[model samples]
Target: MLHFFKNLKIFAKILSLSTLLLLFVIIVAAYSLNQTVLLSDKLKSLSKEEIAFLGVANEVSTLQLEKNIYIERALRLILKRKFNESASFFDGSEPVVNKHNLQLIKKTTEGVQVGLAEIDKLVVNLLSKQWSAKIEKNIVNIREDFNKLKGEIVEFDAKVQAFFAASNISSELIEGEILQLERQQDTIDEHIISLMAGVERLTLDIIQESEQLESSAVKRTVIFTLVSVLVGTCLAFMIAKNIRVNLNKGISVAQQLSSGNLAVSFVANQQQDEVGQLLRELELMSQHFRKVLSKVTESSMHISQLASTLSNNTSDTAKDTEAQQSGIEQIASSITEMVSSIQEVSKNAHVAAESTQHADQQATEGHDIVSGVTESISTLVTSVENTSEVIKQLAKETANVESILDVIGSIAEQTNLLALNAAIEAARAGEQGKGFAVVADEVRSLALRTHESTQQIQTLIRNLQQQASNSVTKMDEGCTYAAETVQRATKAEASLKNIASAVNTINSMNMQIASAAEEQSSVAELINQSVEDISHKTQLNAERTHQISKESHDLSSLAETLQSAVKQFKTN
Candidate 1:
């Protein structure tokens, strides 16, 4: 029975229960209505038949009594006529006999006749109904008695009329007629008594039948009501218990899901009820969640491993960047020293040109001075060659720095891409990956900053390379001027007469060399400053790379944490 109810849909179950209760109510109502109709019919029967019979019978009895009184009065008048022999028959009581007494008797007999007619009509009506055999038999007996009493009343009335008619006869004749009328009256009274007895019997029988019908109606109504109540109560309890059990099962499954027990299972059934559908949906939801969490777990693990690898790579890159920055700083110091050396060469060239002017004033010391000038010019040439070589080396080193900057820029771009990928994965993880998303954003920002710094460094390196190329060009010009000064010094040594001219030319060349040397020194100073800026930028880049490495480690940690969180759900 429970299985049958369970198999039914929720609406069907409730409707079935209501229908049953309604059917029982309808049955009870119909039975009550039928009983009411039966009782109403019995009441109507009592009013129309038994009670009418009793009323007419009573009216008949009253008429019979009045007729009897009238007959007795007539009898007394006859007796009085027998006793008063001296008076005429129609003497003092003539008005009494003709007008009052006979008229009253005649009127009473007519009333009795009317009552009998009514009684006969009621009897015919009762017989037509075809009631119980016992009631019908009683009614038939009452009808027969009424007929007999009616015949007796007619005989008595005729006798009274005969007595009244024979008024001028003898007293003996009047007494004989009076005696006959008295016997007739006695017979009529006997029949009246029998008729009344039959009416009473029939009345009692109808009363008994009504009482039995009322008792049966009461007993049946109570029995049906009790049966309906018991059956309804049992049905309600069974339906409620079935519904409660199923609802409780659904609640249990929901509770399990709420508590994050993805491993919870629910058995499916063929029931098409609302609760069954809910349970099925919950089962599907649990399965879907389990699958999703399992995938999340695997993805988190992979992300963690990738983050770790990224962190390690980032750390190595940061170290390489730091080493590169240190090398660049050393190059900047070397360039500073080279700039100082170039300024010293410019000063020596000036002092050598002063010595050449002194040689023009003292011609006898001209040869020795020219020898000293030639040696100074040769040394200046050697210095210029050295400066040119240094400038070329600086340009080469600048090119190397540009290549390193390119590598750093590439690393920064790669880091940014990795951060972007991490952010995407974190987004895929939903609310669980909110913290990881924040970390990914931070990493991306750092990578962006690193990329910007790399770009700035590359710009600075390009400027430094441009400055180095300019410096190399200036150094080559200084070298050519030194070689020309050396040739002029050798010519001055061979001809004393043109020594003055040669000294002036040497002074002019020395001034030009000094100016070029000063310009080169300035360019070297600018180059040195640019190199320092590049070194500063490199340091900053290295620091950002280190930060990127740290962020990657944090990202790896976050991935591990996410994996751990997903592990709490027993998916698979």
Candidate 2:
């Protein structure tokens, strides 16, 4: 008996050790799974925050792009105008250069604004004063040179005219001087063409820089997202693996014990030191399991007898519950059929009410459209009246042009008279006045050409006035048609308003229909609630039936135990 007990102790130790190890493994596995879940949740939260931060960074990038575009445009405008002077932009600005932009974004949009403002002010000042003076001086010199050239052209024209009169002058000599004058005019035109080309090249360079900055900002955003994802993935994998390894060690110990090795124990070899104390506790519990189990076996045998009588009673109870369960199932089926019928009727009523409301909204939109059309037509008529007034102003400007032309003609006549007097004085002065005589002749011929040009311009102005008068007549006819269209549109709008008002009455009727449908829906909901209540009561009954079935199954298990105990006392 001692040997038997000794062997049993060994067996119980093995079995209990197996059980404890298995429970520990299960606990560890559950703990590991919990840790993985927590880490996964944390990673998800971090990813969301990272994504939100990236969005804010992207917003800053977008604002930076807008600022860059503004500055580049302002700079190009300055270069295009050929102004090279700078002006200050520091006047205690709202988005200060050294404050918000510098700190938050790590790039200064306000600094760029400051630079651009300075560039723009410089351009404005240069264009206003220095460039203005340069252009004015150059224009004055060019005009003076052009007037001299014009006088020379007139003298040459006169010489050609004189050559037509002079029988002694050679035609070759007259043609040679005319060719020389044409060559000089060509040289002056070439210089003006070169000046325009230089300004165009400077404008193109500033636009290219702005495009490069925007492309760079987009690249930075893509790179930041990829790096964040990679870091989160690595961190999640490391934490999950550590938890899983600890759980697997406990499972290995449980498997060894279940194979009936009494000496089975976990090797608590972790550097963390928590596994050491847990292994000692498991070892001590295993040493005493056999003694406790022997006492429990004796109690189990006595309990087995009581279970036998319960098994027979449970068998009788099972037959009764089957019939009750069948009846509850039939009641649940009947309630489902009633709910289906109510839903079908409610759906049809809802569809009809929706159609009426949609028709009302359409009528209201039509009224608004007709009203908009009337307002647009009225605007067109007003625009035509304003255009007629502008044409009248054009007519007045044409009249002014005619008056200026008349003044120019009178000035040319005076100039011609003065030149003739100078020429007469130079003729009396003899050899000393030869240059004076040439200048007087040239001025007299230029005056005659100017007088002719003025007369031609006056004739053109009169023709323009006649055309403007014809345009005004056509505009009046267009205005009259537009007024008629507006009147028709207004009448259409009034009709649509009446239609919309009628739709309102129809909509009100639809609302009452909808209210009736809602009442029907409420009744259906009550019926559905009653059906659900029936279903719940039926489910509760089913659950009670299932509980009875479970109790019967337990009773049968106990009855087997009772029968075995009763057999132990047989033939006493």
Candidate 3:
């Protein structure tokens, strides 16, 4: 609408400029024709003026010649005394003479008046006779004056003749001038008429051309306006149609998308403009939406399958784990029992080792005691050798005592011979001699008892020496056995210590194995939990994929609707 107003303004300006140009052309043409008509009128007036001037110069020259002839005839007749004839002849020439005279009189009178007036007041004081006398005397005494007057007359005549001749020439010149003026007048009139006719024709032509130009301008404006409006209308309609189609499609797509459907297809309209590009883009978008929908559907199915597998696997794993846990508990209990048995064995071994150590200590002490006893026995054997030497000396001493007793027996036999002598003497003393014989017999009995006691004492000493030797031999044997026993016990104790160290190593290995088994069980439980979490995540993903598929289906349906709407577009 604004563009239309602007075009209208431009058209008004063009129209005003054209009108101004036409007015200027018409004014200039009218001014040139008016000047031509005025020149033609002035030329005709000048031609009439030339003709009148030629007639007046010819008539004045003829009157001056007739006056000269009449004067000469009257003078000759008067000189001959032919008064009557002269009078008669004068009478006969009267009209001609009078006519000339009158003309002369009139001319002379006008010259006299002008001269008299210039003579100041002297002319007014002079009488008619005086004037006449002045005229006659001047005419008689001044022959030179008369001659000069005659010459003047002649000159006047010559001037008259010259005027007449000039008049003839003027006639001819005026005739020629008149003829030229007439011709010019005729030519001017013809040109004026022609110019007028031309002006009329030009005016008509200009009017027609202006009208045609105005008509053409109006027609061009109208045609241009119409074409513009038509093109604009077509453009507006196409734009409005495109907008309506897009809006309708968009609204339909939105509605379908809100409802959630996923099994629709899209179609695009074809064109060769921006609308076509948009439609192609929309079609591509719809295709992509469909592809996305397909992928979403596939993903949902896969997730469902995965969820089912996870649930089944979790159930199986749980059952197997329970059985394995029970078995592990049994194993743990058995291991606990075994540990207790090992501990008991360790305590028993500790006690046995202590006892062995104690026995070994006692055996070491016994070895030292036996070693001292062997040394004491060795000293006892040396003392036995000394005792045997002492026994040999005592036997030598007893043999000597027996020799003294044999000597005493021989002395007693001699004494018995002496007693026989003494008995003879005692016969004299019969009672004293009987008492001495009885005392000698008692002394012999006492000596026999003492000898038996001394023999028994020597046998008791020999028995004491044999018992000391046997005691020393038994102590030496005890010492040898005690040293051997101590050596054996030390070796046995070292062996037992080595066995205890091996048992501790076995216990350490068992603990490490049990710890590793516990760690394996913990890892298995974590794996089971992870499997369950994976199942839950898969289910969530499936739900999301399903939602996306539904959205895509709705979009595809809307795209199809949009394509259908755009199909109605008009290009022609």
Best by TM-score: 1
lDDT of 1 at 103: 83
Instruction: Quote each prediction's TM-score.
Output: 0.50, 0.37, 0.21
For residues 1-572, write the lDDT of model 2, one tens digit per residue: 43332223333534644565566556555655565565455445435533443343344335444533443343243233324332222224323532333243223444433433443343333234322334435434433443453344344334433432433223355356446535543443343233222222222222232244345544554554455456545544543454355446656655654554435654644323233334455556545543444444565555555555554554565566556556756765776676576666657666766776677688778878987888888888899899999999999999999999999999999999999999999999999999999999999999999999999999899999999999999999999999889888788878877877877777677667667766766776676677667666656665665565566567657656655553432121
lDDT of 1 by residue, 41-129 (tens): 86688677766777877787787788778777766765675687645545554645446777887888888888888888877878887
lDDT of 3: 0.46
- Full-model lDDT for every candidate: 0.81, 0.56, 0.46
Q: Which is the winner by TM-score between candidate 1 and candidate 2?
A: 1
Pick the winner on lDDT between candidates 2 and 3. Answer: 2
Local error of candidate 2 at 197, Å?
94
* RMSD in Å for all candidates: 47.7, 39.5, 66.0
The model with the greatest lDDT is 1
lDDT of 1 at 24: 81
